[model samples]
Target: MPRNSDLTPDKALAVKWINDNVAQLSRDHMTIWNLHEPSWREYKSSAWYVERLRAEGFDVEAGSGEMPTAFAAVWSNGDGPTIGGYAEYDAVPGASQDPVPRRQPRVGVNRHAAGHTDPHSALGMGSFTGFLAAKHVMERHGIKGRLKFFGEPAEKMCGSKPVHAAKGYYNDLDAAISFHPHSFPRLANSCFWDTHSAPYWSRIYTFECDNPETWQNAGAVTGVAHGHSAARAPGAIDAVCLMYTSSKYMKESMLPHHGSWSLNEFILHAGQAAADNIAPGLAQIQYSLRAPTLDMCARVFEVLDRNAEHCAAMTHSKVTANWITRTRAGLANHAMAEVTWRNFEAIGAPQWDEKARSFAREIQASLDIPPMEDPFTPEIQHLTAPWDGEKAFREQLPSWQTNLAADDYVDYTWHAPTVRLYVGRPTLRAPNPGYRYPEWTRHAMGGVPACIDPMWLTAGKVIATTILDLLSDGVSLDKAKSEFRERTGGGIGGTSWIAPLLPADFAPPVHYRWPEYVTTVRGQEWTIPTAAP
Candidate 1:
């Protein structure tokens, strides 16, 4: 058993490394627009990390699957068991912010806010901690085996799905470990199901009306005028209105609560070099649709196409429609979740009270927060049940029959065994006196070298220790796995489970394109775009 003292040196080193490197990491992660674009510089940053690992005597590989920043590093002591540690360093495009907040004089100028309050700078540091801990253990105890670190990019908006599919990254590892920062401290045993709210597809359509007389009459009669009306007298603008009204009916009729659908980006008279005399083109409009299943999504698209064709026929204008992009089916992987929960508990993280856990139940039950569903006095307490893997799996299996009496579609109960945990600085306020602050978070960020540095060191220690426990020979991986499963109420094959509300036969779409680029900025990926102009 490793004590807190066992991780002190590694943690100290990690905190130092992160504090020194955060600015560079933040810059790399926040600059990219798309992960698939070659312009993103995260690829280079990942390579830099790899070189650092090499200096530490680890074997490193880069450019996994054309994704520039995606890489793997390994330290092996003969051929024994293998353990993996993963880290994510992607940024949310719209969430860029400065390290600290600015006051009044700077308020109106879009001062840095909302970027990486969760500070993923800690991930790399944490991973480093794991790496060094393993190094120390191997050196001191003569433990022989392989410890691998994965620099995983683009997790905002669930980028991991594609990474998982493209690289088969997690498929062969004996076990994997990672962590994230959060407001509260508790292990997350339930992972969100990757179920798309509805299959929603989007299309952009442009219409041009060439009839001069009709164009002028329609615009004048409707009491609508364009700024550039004098240069182009084409009836294009009128045609756009006609299309808008036509699509509005279609939208209202198909609307389903939390179902599928949406329409936006209505651009009118957008073409340049078109003055008065009824411009040659009326307008361009973009419409989005969401549905519960692929079939329904397809049906919505067909309706959109038919609506466009009808608009074309009525306006006697050319109409061109094209699909923009389609997201994959939402995910709900019970098997992977089962494995995740087991690993979480085996790590000895604290658990939450069943009564308090009901907050999640409420969210699941409503499928949304309330004020949205206040009219019905549904059983709110039912939402708080702990996730039961066996129950969820049996219910999701193809052989299971739908039970109409139960609210299959309600999503009112815990559905999976996905866990999330937070380790904070010791300086943070404690809920009460009896509870000792974990010292974990506080010490990692505020100590002499700073608490963040040490936290990373501790992370490495935890990863190495956990991996050793899991992969050691005669260690009863199954028993350890079972113990974790039992904490979550059982494996997915058990009987007392409620089926997920998702449609049967749904499969998540697989993206085969390798990431064209990797951003290296600190924080969530979406924050990057917002951070800039």
Candidate 2:
């Protein structure tokens, strides 16, 4: 029998370190909240993380995976088993608000600028605390392991992680831990085991009718070709419209309504020069599809391709589709998930005190709902299993489905044995046991210190302790890896496992007309861009 060192002491130290540094983590979380950058434009937010990681003595790669906003930081202590901790710092575009109980957007910020809705500000900082805390204790105890921290941007777009996966960033990990703010009532204080996320592939299809002359000439209405002005082709605008309506009409039939799959379409660019209207030449439509399997995504894309082609041919235009992101469905390691959950149980769920409750009352009063002495129920503060809460709600979601929502973090599951952890975020108590809270109410609560800090701190403690578990105990790591190989068809490229969906040389959609801030005579600000007057 092999003699093993006690992990109980290391776990204790990691928890203490996280608790001791909660104030610092809170400050960092506030900084990221104020930055509030959206998608590929997270320059300030990304830079701040890089600076902080460098300060902590990790060998920093400023722009890993060819994404400007993404980074990888590595710290090794004589190297036993390598573990990965991931962070997502991107903000959602539509909503921007301050931390006040009332709804108020940030001042001196663009009216259309992004805000932390999933509140990735806390997500990143919370993970940051875990990464640093684990590293701190590992060094003190002479532990042997390598810790890798990755800064993943554009999580809202379901972007970044797939590219990193394709470029082989996660190829060498023994195990990984991923955390997100839990919005679902059922998954609080829980970690995912078997069913994981569905596959997500977002593509942009561009339709170009650069020359109506050809369309007119080809038609030749009277055997005498009509002039460009008189015989105008419907052009890109009609092509886009046809595709949109056609897809909406075909939505139900794309796949059997039996499974949980969704298709969302956005008009990215529609006619560059609408005023001129000499057959408005260019249009772009982005279709983001999510399904439980990649084969399902491919099947849906085939129909979409046919729709774009038919629409383009009808309008005498041509269409081209580009993959904005392609993430495979999640893989699971029961051992790894159990290990993470055990650490979470040791740490306990976030403890919300009177201050957080007081703030919840303020929000309730603002909503004109009578405030309760304790606004949040036990679900918000107590830890529960994935199967513990709201059976009726769980029943509505099909059991065969592992992932109801599409998130790019699922990409990591294929690379290494990973556990997806979810802890509770702030939610309104609601006027009644079943009343729904306003969107802005929950969004505002996410930014409030009292409402969100417990989550950040608790998540930090759990993540750090879990990392230490695998690092110190070879039995824990081997069990995780063994289960991973069994599930992933012998790891990465096993019989059933496939390579990353995107090709290695595939280009990042950096040039796409993503939303961002523009500098003008009034200095710098962010908003959805507008056409020139």
Candidate 3:
């Protein structure tokens, strides 16, 4: 393998490459909505990165399977077990953005306040570094093996599943490693890994009610309408609120350890009308439910369905629930984790002191939070301790388990060894910290060219070196996989390291509520405007 010193030089080069190319990269991927499109922004970014890899002597292939942007590039010495490094560069809609000097008018009108905080941008750099490091190791040690870089896109809504189904990307790989940037450095044993890193399922429910004159005639109908008639009325607003409230209650009652439920989008079909006269004809709601295992997720869905049925009966509305997407069970390869832990220990990354550990214990006690009942927690700190497993397992309650129908169940098996790493970043700390939207634009645009570029490059070096170590002298894949599974089992294990807390201070809240409106040009047909123009 290349000497650690030789691998060090590439880190500086990686940063320079990211800085020099970030603007063009950002612009190429820019869209009317600023969210990634699998065929557009994501595909183009993949091509661009692949071209860079080619220039560095890696064998690059663009457009894997039906996915236009998905690609696999390989560098091999002669013949050996293949190791996979993955990257994703998709951005979220309405996330924060970098401000520029010129004010550009809105296009599709959707814009992010903070962009790429999920750390996909860093993935590009990290994967690149991994590939480079693997190449170096093979050359130095004359090892006959292959290093593969998989450029994955559209992970925002778990877009990789379709690609996986069509291309079978993971079927052939011996092992895979990827990382996401968060608010702090965490080891595999941490609770953050356990809670957030598990496989999950998403359910979207749409409730539609047809009541054009219910609100307008509500008062006119008097006492008869207030009770029995009102019960029969299909009130869209009531249905939406009822469903939302019921789901919240259900989630609390379930008290699941590895699952979460939340409501996202709500669309009401009232058209443009005064509040008293506005009788909505339709209401659509999006709900997300996640669990560590598919069976758990399925159980949660059963509860979700029961809750939905109850809401529908109470509100007298028709509801349809659908599974939009599902991710495979998270693989906590014991072998890979131990190697990573050793690396972290050797590097002397921050360790939890006894006082800090005591403080965490006190916090848990104060909250009456049983010791890590659920594998996941929003509190990223205190997630990494070997001894905490028994306590965590003890806290798992029976009520958390829900009965599931045959159709609702899914197996919880992973195809191969996988490890997901998380790194801390600035945007994740405070998404909007009093920075004007315009200022945010400037920060995003300028910051990418300055900070992100170099940071990605540095990330690339670290990841690349790690890959080299694993490929050359690090450890065997089978051994790593066996060890990782033994240690983590089906849980995130423990908690020790905590992510840095968000600053207590709040930014001046931007008070401008999204104005409801519909605009029509000369050639447009006449229509009632939805909001005050």
Model 2: weakest 10-residue lDDT segment is 1-10
The TM-score between candidate 2 and the true structure equals 0.93
- Using lDDT, give the best candidate's number: 2
lDDT of each structure? 0.42, 0.82, 0.46
* Higher-lDDT candidate of 1 and 2: 2
Winning candidate number (TM-score)? 2
lDDT of 3 by residue, 24-127 (tens): 54443342113332212354467677787788687877766445666777777886777777667765444434433233322333342224544466556555
- Residue 184, model 3, lDDT: 32
| Residue-wise C-alpha lDDT for candidate 2, range 176-220, written one tens digit per residue | 988988866767668776667788889898999888776655454
> What TM-score goes with each of the models?
0.47, 0.93, 0.57
For candidate 3, which ten residues in a row score worst on lDDT?
Answer: 403-412
Candidates, ranked, lDDT: 2, 3, 1
User: With candidate 3 superimposed using the best TM-score fit, by how many Å does residue 58's alpha carbon deviate from the native?
Assistant: 6.8
**Model 1 TM-score relative to the real fold:** 0.47
- What lDDT score is found at residue 98 in candidate 1? 31
Q: For residues 1-533, write the lDDT of model 1, one tens digit per residue.
A: 12334333433333344345555433433332112121123554466567777887888777553455667778887777556665555543223333211111112222232223234445555555555556655655566777777665544323332333333443344444445543222212222233212233555677766554443344444335554442334344555666677767667665454432345544534444354343455567666554445455577667777877777666557778754334333323333333334333333332223322332233233333232222211221112112442245335433422221110111211222222223332123223356453222321222112223333333434444544444443453445344434533553324543333222332322232222222345433322232454
How are the candidates ranked when ordered by TM-score, highest leading? Answer: 2, 3, 1
